[model samples]
Structures are given as structure tokens and as C-alpha cells.
Target: MTTLLEPVLSVRQVLTLERVLAGEPEVVAGAGQLDRPVRWVHVAEAADVGVMLSGGEMVLTTGVLLAGDDELQAEYIRSLHRAEAAAVVLGLGRAFPAPPDVMRRAAERCGLPMVVLHRPFPFAELTEEVQSRLVRRKFAAVSLSEAVRTALTGLITADAPLQRLLDEIAQHSGCPVVVTNLAHRVLATAGERPAVDDVLRDWERISRQAGRGEGDGWIRAELGGRGERWGGILLCGYRGDAATGRLLADRAAEALVLHRMLGGGSAHSWEEQSAQSLLTDLIGGVVPARQLLPRARAAGLPVNRRTFVPLVVRDGDPGRLDRILRLLGMPGLVAELTGRSTAVLLSLARDQDAEALAAHFAARLRTETAPGTVVAAADGRIAWDDVPAGLREAQHVAEAVADSAAVLDLPPVVRLRDVHLRGLIRLLRDDPQVQSFAERELHGLLREADEDLLSVLRTYLATGRNKSRTAQLHHVSRPALYRRLEAIRTRLGVDLDDFEQAASVHIALLAHDAQQR
Candidate 1:
């Protein structure tokens, strides 16, 4: 079985080894500093050997050169401290056969750990054992780093999605992986379902408290390029040393940055995709809503005991809608749907007025965006199971008004009641009987491909068959309009003066237009 390897050994861990324990080592000073990392083990006998050392090395000595001079012993300890050595192990056979107060006091003052072996121990055995272990660990760490790098690069080359990359990282780190924007909104996640959900349930608090470095088992690395930071990737609750976790996080960050640069997506695009996936699944209803409750919660949507308002906007921009939600301090999910429409699912408190909030959203959309933007909404639902039908109803309403929004005096938010006959036609547009009726009723004009007559008829019927209004709107004289209406009547074999005949043609035209859309 493969296990994670720590790159460096702490001084305390080094002392507990069986080979080092054979010497009966006892900590005489700086016991509180025993957790310091030891990079290597060195055996130096010279009194001024501190100059020949780098930091984090455990220096082993017999103290033979400083046996007679107390000042020299103190200076030696000070020199090792200045060199930033991890600790000093003194074999006390010839050098006073006991712990020296001068050196111990100096080490304690400098906060450098000092150990003394109380037996005849060979420094070579301890050094060989530790050195080999360190070498093996270092090699393992390098191997792990390379393994992660190769796996990530291979996935990138295969054109894997962002979630796949995160999953790969999570598998290697044995923890949940999260990608977030600068504001700490989680854009993507991968790992065990329950584990990822647990992380996301309290993500805001955790993100605020986590630094952009290793903390406990949480390691974070910035995801950006060209000297601009846009987001970050985190390894949450990793069960490994800081060094190993850091290596994993840094490698993952590099892969993520490259993925984004190689057209994986921007942070906003990733968020949009996430919303799209969830909303698509919700609307599709292939999976039951109860089965998707965990997903909704993990996506940062408040689902418990909240009123859900399902809305669809015709020709709406998802980005602008998301911004409006943020500006209003409303929690919602926005995503672009098919047919140039966008879906916005708002999670509101039970006390709030869903209709008013949806109207407010529509008002803001009209004010900040296009004045004719049509927002269609369904009745607010208090249960999660009702949301799918609500979304479908809103979509139906939006589609019903898509072609006639400019002419209809729709409220800020259009609902099913507001759509009337048009909504029914839209719902039945796909029916074979409706399609055949529309084709047969409009066959003459459709076959002619004369858009001028069709437009005149559409405007005339839309205006309650007001001939004067149709003539004026079409910029034609009454005589010319009469001739066109006569031509339309002759082609469709219907009487323009008869109300029932005109209504039948009007319904056919609406159904035809709906089908075309």
C-alpha cells in the first residue's frame, strides 16, 4: 500500500527512533522547541563548526574541543543557534561525562534544543539511519509530486472538464477539493458526496478563517496568471503533513491555472456552468427533487423551509440577472436556458412576499436593462418537489409572451393568468392537431411567402380588427389596406367582416408563430 511521506522529520520524532533511543538521549534544554523540523543529521567535532552548517540540521558532537573552557562552550551553543540549527546532541563520555550547565543555559536562552546521550553510542549509526530515512522520504515526496503533476497534465491534455480536474486532486489528496472566486463563493467541488456537502454547508465561515497557506490540514493555493489573482483552489481536511499538503495544493493550482488559460473557463463562466447544470437537472426532472436536495444545498442555495420563486426572462442576460440578485442582497441562482431565455430561481424567506420580490427583480431588470424585457414567473412554491413544475410553468409563460411581449400590457412579472389564450397556444404548439390546423389555416399566406400581407393581418387582428389602426401602423392608405385585406380574405377563403372567421385565423396565426419560435 502507498502512503503519504513527510519530507522532513521533526526533532521530537527523530529522538524517538530506536537507533537514537539506544543512546539514552535526554532533553536538557529548549524542550519546548522539540517540534522544530530537522532537515538532515550532521556530525561535527570542530568548536567552530556552526559556520560550516545550514539551517535545520541536527548537529551531533562529543564536545571534546570545548571541555576546558566554559566560555567556549557557551559560545559554541550561541554559534549553533545563530546558524539556525535544529538541535545539538552531545555524546557525554569524554566531555565532562554529564550535561554542562554553560552549554545548557546558553541553548535555553537561545531557544535551541540541546540533547545529551548518556551512553557510549556511535554517531555513525544514528546518522546512517536518519540519513537513509530522510533520503527515502525526500524521494517519496518527489515521486508523489511528479505523480500528481503527470496525472493532472494527462487529464488536461485529454480536455477534461474543471470538475474532473478537481476530482483527480481530491483522489490524490484524500480530501475534498474546492474552487472559489476571490470573494470565496465556491464555484466547483469534488470529493465524497457527504464530505463535500459538509464543507460547503459552512463554506463562508471556513473561507473567511482560512489563510492562503497551509493551516492544520487545509492547504490553499492561488489560481491566477499574469500577475492577477482571480480565484483559488483548496484541499480541505487533508490528512497529511503541511509539506505534503502544500505540494499537492501547489501542483493542483498550477494545473487549474493552466486549464483556465487554455480555455477551460473564467471564474464567472464556471459559476454560470455550475448554475446551468443544476438548473438543467432541476428542469429536466430526470432525477427527483428529493434526490437533488444535497446538490442544491451544496451549491450554496438555501433550500430548507424557503419559498422558491421560479422565473424565466426572455432575451435576458444571465450575468446581469446575477448582478441584480447580488445588488438586492437576494440569494438566487441564474443561468441561461435554451431559446434566448434565462432562468432565475430565488430562495426567499417564508415571511417575504414572493410576488413582490419577483416583481422587484423584474422592475430592476427593466430599469437596468431593456425596457421591454419580459419576466415570466410561476406561483411561489414552499416545497422542493414543486419547483420543477414551477420552472416549467414559468418557461411556458415566458415562451407564450416572447413573440407578443411588446404589444401586451404585461405587468412587471408575467404569470400564467396573464398569458390567457396565447399561453394555451404555446403549450399546444407541438401537438399534431394544432400544427395541422395552423398549417391548413395559414396555408395560402404561408405558401405565398408574402410577409407584407401577413404583417398587415397580424397587426389588424392584434388591434381588435381596427382597420384604421392597422392602416396607420403599416403606413398605408385606407384604400390600399382595404385592397390588402380583400386579398387576404380571397387567399384564405374567409370573411374579414365575420368575427368568428377572423378569430379562427387569429388563433391559427398565433399558433403558427409559437411553433416557429
Candidate 2:
């Protein structure tokens, strides 16, 4: 869960009434949310009760409802107020010279969404608008619970590969599927396979074009990226259901984050299984990342900050994640489980920056998911070959493997990519460059040599050119080490004697292998 339910904007809610009434915005304190559309108009023929309306509801009268006495004119205007109408419009030729001034003053007391119309508005449009809003509301409710169940299902068992998952999700949602970073870089894609690498590139275009006050299905939401994290959003969908998109997008975001989290985080077996099941089920079928956005809008809710970095939650009632999203901007905290028992999470306040986001996620995980539930956050922003950079991808590698392993031992969601490196190494070995380097440059070193080699190089470079101690620790005869040194020089094609070359080799070689491993 990555979002907190924001206060429903009353202005827009009122306009819903206006559009239904076929009324114009005569007056609105906060014009931003209103000034546009409404679905309900109070058409009352009673006394001028238009003043009673709260606002944004048009009052319709035929004057027949108050046709008789001059003394009762003021009473008629009062009725619009009773209906809480937006504005009162005297149907032309209905009453004598319109109700007395005394009645209009009373109508002015309350700021109503009253509008006078020269003609009777079509009521069919109102009905349709009301039905549309209702439909939206219904979907919103469905999406909320659906998000929870889906999160659990993603944690369930699955045999599909990453491409299959993306395909299914896109088919269901009727939109493109993309996995992005805080920088809006597309790490992977599902629907628009033809443009897989364009995810980030497109994000750049959409982010620049997004604007506020546009209440279309297409929207820009902020995901927390303060610190070393990825924050982004699903820009648009064909249906333009912003409300539905919020619910669906958050689930997808959580799934990705939890999927990433499981590689290194802690989660119980049951929790892990549930999350995978939902993810598999959701993506395995036709699923759209923005499926729930429309529903959110109908519920009179506002979605802020599209990028909700997910925290993976497992067996632990991933519902907590959904709840956390609702609580995020409210009380300043949120959390969830993406793939069932695989991972749990929390989203902090937007003002809280990167370090704060990470810190809050860690602290909240300790409070909710379990003590020490949050282990580490890996971001693609790190140097592609650096350990810190690979940490993020490694976690996902672990997740993909764990998802496969989930078919057995009740499965575990805490995936560590290194566990699968052996298989990958075998695959990459087909490349002669990789094979030769492993056989020659890294030869004589144990299987675990890669890990220590990087560490040793890092430390060795830190110590300057110190051969005697380097040989002593390598546990080698100094002369024998010298012979090996000459061998290293031959394979590496650089002089260890050159200060710059030594440092460069250490970083370039180790960092490169670390990423692949």
C-alpha cells in the first residue's frame, strides 16, 4: 500500500450536483474544484427554497408550485434553501414580476449553487451523470478490496515468466505495462513490447506534459523518492479512470516493490505465498495498472503523488498495506505486502525526503511488518556495476527465483540473487569473453572468489601499492606471488606498476562482475 486516502473535495462533489441540474457556476469560493461539472441539480417548484441548498445544485421552478398569493412569495424562495439547491431560477412567465425583493434577500443569505435557466433542462443527462458517478463509486469499492486480494494472489504460485506477467496485466487493464524507477526509467515492459526500452523515455515526455486541474483519467501522481529510491507513476490509460488507476496502480507498485523486497527482506511462508498468488493471478490474467483509478474518483477521494514506493509484506495480513496507504498523508505513514507473505511495507509523508523515506519505512516496518522487517532498499540509480547498484536488481533476481521455488517448501519470499548466480554464470559462460575471463583471470580462485576479490581489490586499492603485505595475506610465497603477478599482468593487459591502471582495473573488473553475478 503506498497511498493515503485524502479528504474528499466538497467543491467537486457539489459540481457533480450542478452538472446533473444543468446549472452554470454562478458563484464558487474555491473555483478550482468546481467551475467544471456536476451531476445533480435540485429542481424544486415549491417556494423559493433555493437558499436552503448547500451549493452546486440548480433549483428549477415552474412558478405553479407558488402560483397563488403575493404574501407567500417569500415562502417560495425559502423552499430552494430547503432543497439545498445551487441557485434558484424563476421559470419565465411563471410568477408575477418574479418574487418580491424581500424574498430574493432571504435567498441570498445562503450561498447556494443556484442557477436560473431560461428553459427547463433535460433530465436524462442528469440521470446519466448520476448513474455514471454511482458506477464509479461501485468500482472504487471493488478495486480497494480487489487490491488486497490481488496483492495476496500475486504472492501465490505462478509458472509464468516476467514477460507473461506483464502481458496478462496489460491485457486485463487494456493499457501498456511498464516497470519504472524513481527516475522514471523503464526497467521492463509488458504490453508495449515493441517499445520496451522506451519506458523511461516516455516517462520523460509524459512527466513534462502533465498538469494540475485536469480531472481526466490521465494524471501525474508523486511517489516518494527522497533518498536512494525510485518514485514514479502510471501516466495514462485508455479509459482515463484516475480513481480506478489509483487503486490498481498502487497494487502494481506494491507488487513490484514487494517483489524486489523479498530478495532481501524477511517474510513468513504463508505471507509470501499469498502475495505471489495474487501477483500471478492478476498479471497472469488481463490486468491494467490503472484499473481502480475511476473507482477512487467516484468515492469522492483525491489521489496525490503517483509514485508510491511499495514495501513488500507477507503472511502478515497484507491488508495492512492497503490500510497504510489510506493512512500515509493522513497521519504520515503507510505499508503493505506486495506478493503475499513475501513482503510488507509503509509510505511516509511526501515532505520527508529520500533518507527520511527509507528511515521511515525501516522504522514503520519494525513497528508493523515485524521488527527488522525492512532490510535494504536497492535503487537502479547506483552505478550499474557497483554492489549498491546491483543490490536492487539482486533482490528482484531473488524474488523471481523464490517465486519459482514457491511451488515447494511452502516457499520463502526473502530471495537473495546470489543463490541463482551459479545458474546464470553457466548461461553467461556461453559468451567466450565471459568464459575466458572466468577461466583465466579469475582462475585458481575458489568458487567464492568473486565476492572476496572485489572486497580485496577495494581494500588493496585503499592501501596504495603494497605488494609485500598483499602477498603475505594471499598466503603465498613472495616469489610465487611475484610469478602470479606477472600472470595477472599478462591476462589483464595492463601494468600493475601504473598507479592509474591498478585502480581502474580494480574498479572496472570487480564492479562489472559484481553486477553480472
Candidate 3:
């Protein structure tokens, strides 16, 4: 309708589009001089072409939108051109002339893309270009918003994660992709790298050097003006084009907004905060690296590079590790323990990748722990300038794995450790759906409760069958504690004294921490 937002368009965008019509021109606008500062494309059936346009969009016509004469044809073309139509394709064999002189003059006047689709031209070819143009014209933020919408819907409705949506976008570009925050911290990534789970490992060491930057194919993008601020980098491999960068930035902004709304100090910290919260309490940190390494090595991570790092824990936090591995494109499996917590085990193809990721995990753990309390490893020696956030993600993944396993499942998990409990926690925690029942029922409480119910449960568990003690620790009384515990048992349908059932509740609480971290 009415807005302050502007659309971005480029000529090359035409090639990446879907078919607009059956006989549309497979027109290729290589000049890349299409009108910018556009709004959106719409099919207007109104008689006056100019009046119908909201701006942007290459209007497709059989020349029916224009009812003007020879002189008016030029005027009409000029009118559409002035409205900033990126391009105008007039299909031949329609009422409009094959080579309308008026369009030529207007093209010269406004420099808008003007093409006359010859009769019988396959619209499929033309549609791809149109789709490409339309996609590029979009605000990358909007595209990511769409992705977020789809991902969230999929997360709840079809059971998917943001990673799948990101993978889809990366697949579209046919290159490795790094999605970052507004400050350029990578939150998620896809495609091959020197190693698994090393997103900006050791960024504080290298990235601190002003503008050494992360990820290849990501050049410094000037958004124009002070306070213009970088939206973040979008790396493109060989198949990546300039549009991919713009789209990545858009997605970056959208993701930033989503994470910010998730609760953080600012746009930059939102991704980190949300991720920290999501993986924080998973017993064994997330990663399926062991299962994934063979493939990553197959791709080039470990050909002659036998060097490795161990994500040590007695067992692993599969969900936490899964998030990390999912982010890293690493793979592993989760397993459940009969008498212990879940666990996970994975490996990075290279050594430095392991070290860098270890650093990220360490920092996140500091927020909730004492120093040297947690350990995760990464080892890869690639160009340090590559994706710093990836490294950080690797770090956090290591933390999730090491901490989760030690605290909840087993003591001290390792890539090669007998951390079956850690591994089982990871395997069992892999399915957040198990907690979906609590999540839905607890929605009303999360919105209304003055205290965090999850915290209450944890505190109560710590008190060891002593309601008064737990209440005192929580700054509440026995009555309040009892009331809350009853609600939890009722909502969750489990008893604290029933050792097997109570353990599931503990895991659910851990899972909640996993989601937030």
C-alpha cells in the first residue's frame, strides 16, 4: 500500500526467475541497467498503463493495457518508463506493433529495459529471467522474512528448522552460504568448508583486525551513508552472483530481527544470545560430526590432514550437538541411556577447525559457568579470515557437547570417550517434539507466570525431595513450590518420585535450555 521501503532490482535477476506466461520472451537483460528504486510487480488490468503501475516490475503486456494511438504509444511507453518500470516486454502477434517506435524512443528517454517478445517465444525462458529479476528486486530482508515464516511454520507445523530453510536458499545460489547477524556474526551456514563446525573459529584473534573479514566471495558491501551500517556478509562461491550477496544481507537483517525479538542487548548480540540460550543446557553439546566427517573428508576436509580434535565428554548433548552439527553441516547420531542421560559423538575433519569452534563454545559457557569448567575442541588451519561466526558456532557446539554430557548425562564426554550417557542424551534430545506437549500446555503459563517454570523445576529438582528448601532457594515458600510442582506433574503427566519418569522431566527441562541456547 503505502511505505518507506524501496525495492532493489538488477538486470541479471531475470535469469533466475520462473515462467511468467506461456509465450513470454526468454529475454536476457545483460546490461544490468534496469531501473532501480522500485516497489513491486503486479498484474494490472487497468486501461492506463502508467496509472496501473505501483513502480518497479517489468510490466508484461500484449499491449492491451495501452489504448493510445501512434503518438500516444510513445507517450504511454514514456509514462510507464517514468513510473520506473524496470522493463517492458510487449509480446508480438498482439495488438501492439512488432517494433513499436514509441517504445524505442521511451527506452532512449528513460533508459528502461524495453524488449519485444517475438511470436512463439517460450515463456519458460522469459519466466526464469522474470523470476530472477523479481527475486533480486526484493529486499533481502524480506526474502529472509519469507524464509523465516516458512521455517517457523515448518518448525511447528511440519517439524523443520531454520537450517533447512537456509539450505534451500544456499541451494538456490548453488554455493556455500553463510548467514550472519547485522554485525556479521555467522549464526548458521551450509555447504563445504575446510572442516566441519568451524564458522569463525577464533574470530577474536583474527577478525578483530579491522575488515580482514570472513568468508571468501564476500567483499565489502557499501550500503551507502553513515549509520548505513553493514547488514552482514553473504559469501558466494563460484556459482554465487552479486544478487546472492544482496539476498544474504536481506536474510541477515531478517534473522537479526527474529533473534533480537528473541531477546538480546542489540541486533548483533541477538544471534549469539539466542544460540547460547538454545544450546546452553543440552547435556552433551550438539553435533553429529562423527557421522558427518567421512562425508566432509570426502568433500576435501581431511584428505591428507589426519589431524583431529576431540569434542570431549563422557557422553554428548545430541540436541545441542545437533544444532552445532546442523549449523556446521556435520552429522552424528543420538542414543538414549537406560540409567543415564543422553550423549553424542562427532569429529571435525581438520585440527584448527576444532580449535576455533572450541573457543566459541568456551565463551558461551562462561555466561553460565566458571572458567575451565567446560571443554570442546576444534582443529583446522585454513585461512583465519574465513567465516568468524562459524568458528563461534563451533565453539558453542563444543561447549554444549562438553557441558551437557558432563552435567546431565556423564562426566567428561570425548570424541573417543566412553560417553554413552552423553551420547544417549543427544540421541534422545534430538526430538524436541517430545516436549511439544509441555510447550503447548505451558504457553499460557509462560505468558502469565511471574517466575520461569523451567527454573522452578530445576530448583525443585536440586532441593532433593525437600519442597521447603527448594522454595527457600527460589525465594518462595513451600506452598508456592508445591503448587508449581503439582501443575508441572499435571501438565507433564509424570511424578518426581518415579525415577524413570522424573528423568524424562529432567531431560525435558534440559531440552528447554537446548532450544533457547
Candidate 4:
């Protein structure tokens, strides 16, 4: 967890104020430490004022009480140092006219900023001005915190998606907001497209170099609860004070954790959602594939000069498939598309064998799932523009074999060639002529609404009209199977022994099933 620093004015900012500038304040020591945050201002003339002070307070005083005591002057600076004061402001008048070397040297050695007022100025006025500004700043910070919290809470109540929450944070921070899992894989991003792309382009390097402490305008807050750290949210290139940035990051983190808990989604589920959105857009083709390349790279996918293999697995568990990919050290994106099909895109180096890797993935899936699981894949595509077509082809192949996987002898990885006629029927299922033909050929059986006969016909047609095999698989006697086949033929008004008619009925049945799936 990143530490949340309270909103405060820095010593440099305080010195630049109108009231402080009227006194012609000059830095006598610790010039490099002007950026130290000043929590408050205190006016004191006591030599032992440090005992009454706390850290982050700018001490204001004159040399009226310590003009003749060299030891006390040096000790005063040391006391403030030990007390962790932000800086010391002294008026050069009365007891001493010039900056005290004893105190300046002491402050320089301790690295405590020391300033001397060349002209007389009222300490009360400077203190009052600084205090009022500090109070207003603190109030504004609190207001900002509540405003962000309220906005995020309202979004959660309205059931807004994770992306919406990220966008809200980005709007408030005015910078790119990135959410990543413990492995540093970017799950989601929200901001200007170009800025987000730039951050993602160098995400790996940046994430690796980011420390637990904030720096370089990057503030990170861990996203987790109940003593478990799963991921983090980063505010990249936030052009605000460190304190303000910390506040924004901490608020955003709290909101994100609450959103996840309320939605009942694990961090891994968010990753899956991210993959689903990306893949859906890619397959939709509304956005050009080139525009999505940076997102792909940011999501930890290898897309440069790689062979892209698109696969659609019917009834495959996405979590299991992802684990298998990781176990095999393969780079891929897995997401559940519409229906029971899940899409997996493999990005293999050009030198690697895409076919062998896809086959191995299918084999592992079968071992983990069912032996008859159909993994429909398209031919390897080298160009990104060809990915949309590849995904569509794979999906068509999966749907083509979805219903017939039980009877058909399919390889572990089924390709378009393996789907053959079924694949062609799936592609044409939406054609008006094909739909009318399927309905006309099967009109009699469709009107009857006899599921028993429909099942018998589907099995018989799927088995290439092999009577004995269909009967055995359906657990029926040959005589009974013949009776069912005759009933189907009579209902459809087709000759039982006609080769061309049976082939036509089989094609119609394939088309009908494809349309239904």
C-alpha cells in the first residue's frame, strides 16, 4: 500500500506568498531542501522552541533573545533539526543585524532550510496567512475525497461496469488509470486513447521499475482486502502535488476494492472480462485490427511478427484453457464468446509450429475435459488484418461440429477441412434459400413435432444411413430401427432406398441443426 501523505504547503510555496515576500526573505542554508512540506507555521522567540514544536512546522522568530549566546544559537538550530521542523525563519534585526553564521552553519550541516528576513515584517500576519491557506487547502482536499467517493459509490449502486469506474477515476485524476494483476498484466485502462496507448506500450518496463514508494508522477495503491494483495491501480503521469496524487490514488483504490467485492468478481474474472471485450471488438471488425495492436501488447500478448492461430472451443472452460496455456508457456488470449463456445487466440513466434502447438493445446484440453470436446481452428494467419476472418471461420467450424461430435470421428483439433460439408452448411444456414429448403424438406416431420422420430432421423442421417450402427448407438433392435426409419421416410414422403433423396434430407437436416445452434 502506498502511504497517503496529508495535503500540505511546501516551504518553497510558503516563501513565495505575498506576505512572506514583503519581508525579503533570503535562504541562508539548506537551499536544496526548499521543497520540504510545511504542515503549519509557529512564531516563537524561545531558545528551546524546538521542545514545543512538532515535525513539518515552519518556525518563525527573531534573534532578540539569543543575540549574545553562540552556543544557544547553534543549539537552537540543532533542536529544530532533532524536532524535525520543516524550516526556520529568523528576522535580521535588534540583537543581530546579519545572518548568524553559527546558526547558518548548524542548519546547513543538518540540511534544515534556514531563511533570514532582510526587512522587518509582522510574524502574526505571515502566520495568519499561512494558517488560513492551509485550512482551506485541507478542506478542499477533504471535499475532493468525498466527491470522488460519492461518485464511485453512486456508480457502484447503479451497477456500472468496471470500465465505467476506471473512466470515472481517469476523469478525476486527469491521467491514465491502469489496473493490473499481481503478474503486472494490464487488465483494464481508461484515459485518452493516445496516452493510454503510450503507457501500455512501455507497461512492462514501467511496472517493473515502479517501487513501493511514489515517484515520477506515478502513484500506486494496492487493490486487495482481508490481508491478501492481488493487484494494484496506478495513476500514471498525474500532474499534481504528491499529497493530492496520493489522496486520489487511495480513494480510487478503496472504490475499486469495494466495487469488486460488491460485484462478487475475482481479479481473474476482471481479466477475463477485459479479454472478452477486446476479442469481441476484434471479431466485430468495427475497429481496425491495427488500432488494437497496442491493447494486445499491453495485455501481455505477443503480436509482433508472430503467427496468429484462432481457435474456438465448444464447451471449453476458459479458466482451464488459460491455465493450460500458462503451464505450456504459450502466449494467448482466452474468452468465452456468445453461447457455449470459448475463443482462444494463440500468438506463436514465426519459428514455432502453430499446428503442433494448437494440437497440443487441444490434447491437453481433452485430457482436462471430455475426449469428444471439439476445438475448431482456422489456418494460421500471419497478418493481423486476417484475424477477424480467422475467428469467424473457427466459430463456424465449431458450430458445424457442435451437434455431431458424438457420432463423427474428429481429431483433437478439428479444422475447417475436418468440418467439410457441415462447415459449408453452417456458413449458408442464414441464406434465405437454404432456410426455405431446410424447412420445406423437413416440413412433414416439423409439423408432426415427434421428438422420437426427429432424434431417430438425426442419428440415422448423421451416421451416413448406417442402420446397424445407428440402431446400436440408439440402443434399439434392428427391426425397431427399420420401423422408425420407415416412419421417418413416410412422414417426409421420401423413398427409403432413394440415394439422392436421402442425401438431400441429410443436407437439410445439417442446415436445420446449424441454424438452430
On lDDT, the leading prediction is 4
Q: How high is the CA lDDT of each candidate model?
A: 0.88, 0.43, 0.47, 0.89
TM per prediction: 0.74, 0.34, 0.33, 0.88
Q: Which residue window of length 10 is worst by lDDT in model 4?
A: 1-10
- Global lDDT of model 1: 0.88
Q: Which ten residues in a row have the lowest lDDT in candidate 3?
A: 336-345
Candidate 2 C-alpha lDDT tens digits along 367-421: 6754323233332221111322233333344343332232222122233333344
Give the top-scoring candidate (TM-score).
4
lDDT of 1 by residue, 26-53 (tens): 9999999998888888999888888998
For all predictions, the C-alpha RMSD in Å is 5.5, 16.1, 16.9, 3.2
Can you rank all candidates by lDDT, best first? Answer: 4, 1, 3, 2
Query: Which portions of model 2 miss their true places by more than 4 Å?
Result: 1-41, 44-152, 155-169, 177-179, 194-202, 211-216, 220-229, 264-517
What's model 1's TM-score? 0.74
Clashes of 2: 111
Off by over 4 Å in 3: 1-31, 34-48, 60-71, 91-102, 120-191, 194-517
Model 2 TM-score (2 dp): 0.34
lDDT of candidate model 2 versus the reference: 0.43
Q: Could you tell me the TM-score of candidate 4?
A: 0.88
Clashes in each model (backbone N, CA, C under 3 Å)? 0, 111, 96, 0
What is the Å distance of residue 406 in model 3 from its true position? 28
